[model samples]
Target: MTTHLIDKIAWIHLADGRVLSTRSHGRDRYYLPGGKREAGESDLDTLVREAKEELTVDLDPFTATFLGEFRAQADAHPDGIEVRMRCYESAYQGRIQASAEIAEVVWLTYADRHLTSPVDQIIFDHLHDQGRL
Candidate 1:
């Protein structure tokens, strides 16, 4: 059997013990507001670009801090497929709103972990354990 990996990046914005999450158009689960890196793009570049595209905000690369990497079975994918998320926490400029493919923007607590993807649920657990959620 072959194991497949879906590499992705995510912005972990926390406020008042909740995390920022986004639901893409027609999608049922909310995800952190970031995406895969494009060719030749560094993690910061992908983070900034994805944040702008999805949430209408400019992430200050200078203020970005590495959170941690998380992996879990990719939601809706077959067995042996997993998603690896590199998460970062950063300061941003501008108000957040749904843009691009995003249909909704929400703040979720640990209790709302069921509303997110498998990888995001792991992230929620991590945050909760750290007393940040």
Candidate 2:
């Protein structure tokens, strides 16, 4: 089985203690605002770039803090593939408008994470356990 490291960022917007999230261009489920890292890109770089592309907002890389990493059997892709997600916390600039690969941006709470990916369920569990939810 070939394992792929799906490096990603959480891009949490802590406004009134709520987290911002979004859905992919053609998907119905909601997801954290981020995406897979490109070649030669650092985690922070991926976060900033993906955020800008998907949300049309610039991320403060310096303000990005490592959150937690998550691993789960790939649900969206084929079976037997593991996806490793590296999450992060960052402060964003400008209004979040869905631009590139995103459909709609929404602020989510712990209760609203049920529609997230399988791997994200684990991340949400951890965040809840850490009292960050």
Candidate 3:
């Protein structure tokens, strides 16, 4: 078996034990709100840009903290494609509204893992075990 790596940054915004997730245009599953890093962009830079693009919010860099990294099959991609998600917990400004390529914005609890992608399920489990989701 072979695998292709797709690295992405994810933001975990928790409020009342739920995490913020997004459904991109034409996508069925929900995913953590963030995207891949661009050329010359730092992980933080990717996160900041993605959040603004997908959710219309401004992340506070000073309030950003590394949560952890997770890997799993990219369920929506081809068989060999895998995604490694680097997650961050952060505080942000403004209401979260779906924008750009995003179709919907949702807040999910641990039991809602079934609605997310495989990689996000891992994140959900990890956050659940830590009592943060």
lDDT of each: 0.94, 0.79, 0.91
Q: What TM-score do all the candidates reach, one by one?
A: 0.97, 0.88, 0.95
Highest lDDT scorer: 1
TM-score: model 1 vs. ground truth = 0.97
Residue lDDT tens for model 2, 27-126: 8778777887788999888889888988889999988888878888766777777778888888778988988677788877779777888887787788
Order of the predicted models by lDDT, top scorer first = 1, 3, 2
lDDT value, candidate 1, whole model: 0.94
| Candidate 1 residue runs with Cα over 4 Å from true position | none
For residues 1-133, write the lDDT of model 1, one tens digit per residue: 8889998999999999999999988889999899988999898999999999999899999999999999999988998999999999999999999996898899999989999999999999999999999
Better of 2 and 3 by lDDT: 3
- Cα lDDT of model 3 by residue, 29-127, tens digit: 999999898899988999999999998899998889999999999977888899999999889999889886888888898889999999999999999
Residue 54 Cα positional deviation in candidate 2, in Å, after optimal superposition: 0.7
